[model samples]
Target: MEIGAYQDAQFGQERTQERSEGSAGSMADLFPKLVAMQRLCGSTAFAVLSVHAHTLLKPGKIECTTQSPGSQEFVSPFLKLNTEFLLSHLCSSPCPVIFMPENAQAMDSSPACIVRNQAVTETSLAFPVQLGTLGNGFVMFFDARAMLSNDLLIDLHRKSLTVMREKLRLAFGMTTGSENLNDREIECLQLVGNGMKSEAIGEQLNLSVHTVNAYLGSATTKLNAVNRIQAIAKAIRLGIIA
Candidate 1:
């Protein structure tokens, strides 16, 4: 199937309206059609990651789910292990997913491996989904036994990108550059990107550590990073902090 066709199938206006009006608390509710698409493609698991926040947050940094060879729990350690490694290794050049395969080693010891291995073996393929303003991330389907065909993988990847675009818009309240980041928050993040520790930044800026940390915290939320380190990474990427 054509990539554009797959995106239209997954996103289109109808699904967007549904999600906008519905609760996003449950991944089930957020991605019912995507789950169906994964099954249709014969994928064993469907996983999503926010590459930007991987290093800063505990595992399950985003959302991941699967169906086959038994259900897997979304454990915190599993979430942290996978996300931290992916963030550390995946670079922004050529988009983030370019680094995923080479960096699979980062996830080698994760409990999610039992399930992740199902799709990341030598024979399996991974695809980069351009989520636009949501930034770069991957949509992977594991078939340890090679049960899926290349054609299907291609189609699935295309559809996954469309699904992800909408999912990210909803998840992050993403807008164009018009979505302003507060000046204080941006200033704090700029200091952070300069490699200044909170105390050092506080002294340099003539602010208390507590106030500096508060600005960092607000920046973290605005950037959608789980903590200060990831916040710095994101700010740098968005050019909000130089």
Candidate 2:
């Protein structure tokens, strides 16, 4: 069947209603719901999992996982490479959420061949969800065979973002609008992870020493670190720097 045509029939309103009823509570709750949603949308298999400290994308560790049918053969090397590439690409996005379709080109064309040459027998999609304002990591994955409608895909993406946001809020004990950090603070923290000293960073960015210090200090406070070094370390642990 034509891809577009298939998407229309399978992703009609009834499917959306089925998906809407799926409640997402814990990782365990969400995973089954994802798998069920994929099935309802005509996919053979599906999985949804998240990573904590995703350093492969930045500096520290990240929590990520993918779920598929038990019958599917496990390919460790390809999975690792794919995960690495996904995280690296996600680092460039301002919004913490990323929806990556398997056969689609990356936004940044620099590493154009990351997945082009790989042999993918089954169709699949992956989502890279950055956990919190601190850059914790993501949860994602869907079935490509499902040929989910663009509207359905979009709905899932939006819902997934909401779930991740709520999870992070609870995990970090943050309230609405209380933990938002600006881009400058994030950039400064990333530079600190690269071992750039305050004065050097100031020169690199054409900012005054006092301004650089202020950025670092603000970042440190936001990250709940007592000092710059501690801030850097926390940033790394939180997957904010790389």
Candidate 3:
């Protein structure tokens, strides 16, 4: 079935392969940025994970993991960090958290908490970045030394946000200001993000289904997304909608 030129299977394996390739390329290009971030904070390694949001309330169950070259060994341990708990915290706040070996256990409710069974040797600093519907996840820098100073942490946050946005644009081919969505297009996308179908949206907006679809199609193209879902995701991430 198709909805506003979007095939239901657009999200199937074929699209998954395309997204994977895009993500791999994007990370390769952004690896330098990650390295710079590590150097800025005196960390040995870094990792970035994009969590696919299924809904506003549901915990992100799907993940795409990427890390610095030669950091393969760290991936296993990195995943051991209470991801479900960590992600929940990241989603709630945009701030980064510090995790150290000495305090990680006692600070269970702290910004960074490791699972009881997990053994982490290094201190880690993590912060969440919003990538809209494409994927939203956190970037973490790991160091064997002590935690960063307040000055360094502040600078890291500023730089990390810029890097994350660039990653999102590269991974998903999002172009800033390349196309503009008008009032109707933005309205349609906002409703869709809220889980309203075309029919319901049409009724609510007092427009015909075809008109609603037209608006969505235009919005999708403007956002450079492959389909309605992606368009909605991109729009939300771009702050074009709520």
Candidate 4:
């Protein structure tokens, strides 16, 4: 069925209520309908990516995905595209950005050109989701068939945002607390959460080991954490880091 059919159906009302109430909906509650919607939109696979505060272009984690084994091979290649540009565009606009394979081909000099020859889909769509202090993320739909109309794109964007907001609420509630971490402290905590040691994080950030430790220590104090590991865990729970 087309998107209009979905809008006319009872499921559409459910979506409306979900957005209106800001319910703490689970993936299990939304995934089935999302899969059906993707099928209607001619999307073969979809993924929700959580982006780090420091590394906006790099995904901190694949929160969830509907990619099959066959389509999994395309994921790495797809990510090689100009993500910095894509993310900047997302942050600038709330609409869906359509990416054609030819667009990838035009970037032959860049690593993004790799998708030109191997992409399985003729088109893809990306939607940006901003969760204020909680964080920011993206919802990507891959391998679409036809060009989507503006109304459908808008409806889909709203639905996608609804889904993401619910997921974020379930994943990270509004308990970020009064602890305000600076960019450097958050970066250090994020690195520690990813299992990076002080020396390694120092080298990566071009800071001295002492500086890294100082940042971690400051973050630990702000978080009221007794140690680095606890601080990392608290940061993750507080949505201070991915």
Candidate 5:
């Protein structure tokens, strides 16, 4: 469902699309800035990923797969060191600017651990950027020596990300507005992400099971998600669902 001022509809669409059109070609222009941010944050490395809707809907899977990651360029030695863990962590969760094992460090938290044993850096921070209609993506920073504190990480997201958000969104080539969600759909998703089943959600929302599923399905399609679960995850990442 699209919403707009009746008179400004064309103008609004044109404006957002115009913004999207120029972003794709300028993605590479942000590399130098990212490198500078990494240095300022005292991190050893940094990287970015673009979440792709087409890749998310691959057959037989409700979630995006690492076999075909939706990440944008800005690779580094971390990819070669802890490939799958990094992708899974970055792509799956909302992970809004989290410091790895805050106030400390760890090892062997299974395959998805960022540090990945003693081989990589001691600390890592992830900033999950919300690009409005551009879909979701993240910027990660890793530290080799000192523990990257939470304050620093939050500063990066609050101050640094603000400057970088529009630039990164353009890089993703998001010209048009992203999928829209009515109050009903977003309400259903918030409950779903809270571990509610369809029946429970229906009762809570005072609607029939069929109606609840309809809203959910509509949201799923709009988000280009493979299923309700995927929809919920993406919704959380996009700040659509808390």
Candidate 6:
């Protein structure tokens, strides 16, 4: 995420440098790139929203930029840009948020309620972007046809997210830049997400159960999750594991 955030600023710099091409152009200037990134991520729709506040009652009014002109017509059915539960994550890390249909469907939690209440039935990725000078922004990718994962979407995600951040910062003003997770911690969480028990994860990683638990505990602490189940779920939501 640190790498992705850096890439965001770097990409933002490049785009700003090229802004002399057209000061008259609107956010539509980013349409083509949004379309390109949408294809790369296999998303049904891609949007960048500038968030003003992070309160439960007010998600802040959003200035949205989408791929196709008048595409909010297409996006309206799948998501409600402002909801209390959704706004809850804005004050957290500047990492990606993923909602897997299967995982989300099985979890009867507040977030699941938000997803269901909004009538979203597919996978989605949300990148929380906050720049000190620019306020707050969110870039969302919705893939309703199937479930999405970071492993398969990492390259696409990194590039797509970087470009969205740049486009948002340029279109909106302010420059930007998450948690620290080591390989072992991520590995253990991934296996746990795959429905593996700690012992099974240990066997797969060739580590003892105690070591696997330690890694899980460390990841949980880093993620500020309550338990292994919460850790795995948060890991999935944060794009730490597929």
Order the candidate numbers by TM-score, best to worst.
3, 4, 6, 2, 5, 1
Candidate 4, 121: how far from true, in Å? 5.5
Local distance difference test scores for all models: 0.49, 0.52, 0.63, 0.61, 0.52, 0.57
Q: Give all TM-scores, in the order shown.
A: 0.37, 0.45, 0.56, 0.51, 0.40, 0.46
**Candidate 5 collision pairs:** 20-175, 23-170, 133-178
Give per-residue CA lDDT, model 4, range 1-242, as digits (tens): 33345335423554455535645446587676567557757887776666554356755333334443355555566676545655565456444566676544332221111224344346776666665444466677778764465555656666766666566546654333313567789889888877898899999999999999999888888777799888776666544465
How many pairs collide in each candidate, listed in order? 4, 11, 0, 0, 3, 0
Once model 1 is optimally superposed onto the true structure by TM-score, how far is the C-alpha of residue 83 displaced, in angstroms? 6.5
TM-score winner between 2 and 3, please give it. Answer: 3
For candidate 3, what is the TM-score?
Answer: 0.56
Pairs that clash in candidate 4 = none
**lDDT (10s digit) by residue, model 5, range 1-242:** 11123214323343344344333236455566566667766766666654433355542111221111223222444455545554465455433333343435443221122333454324555555544344445666665344344434334554334334545445433323333567788789889888999899999989999999999998888877889888776665554554
True-structure RMSD for candidate 6? 14.3
The CA-based lDDT of model 5 is what? 0.52
Give the winner by TM-score: 3
Over 1-242, each residue of candidate 3 has an lDDT whose tens digit, in order, gives 12212212221332333333433245577778678778877877788867765577875562537677666576556666566766676667555666656534443233233333336666777766664666467777866354455445545654565566556656556564323567788788889989999999999999999999999998888777799988776776653554
Best by lDDT: 3
- Residue-wise lDDT of candidate 2 within 1-242, one digit each (tens)? 34344334433542354345533345455556566555645555544445444446765434335465552343343355466665565565422222333565444422111244345544444445554455434434433454444455545544554445445444555422224456678778778778788799889889988998898888888877788888766555443443
The local distance difference test score of model 6 is 0.57
- The lowest-lDDT stretch of 10 consecutive residues in candidate 2 is 108-117
Considering lDDT, where higher is better, how would the candidates rank from best to worst?
Answer: 3, 4, 6, 5, 2, 1
**Model 1, poorest ten-residue lDDT window?**
107-116
After superposition, which runs of candidate 1 have C-alpha atoms over 4 Å from their true positions? 1-30, 53-125, 132-134, 144-147, 172-242
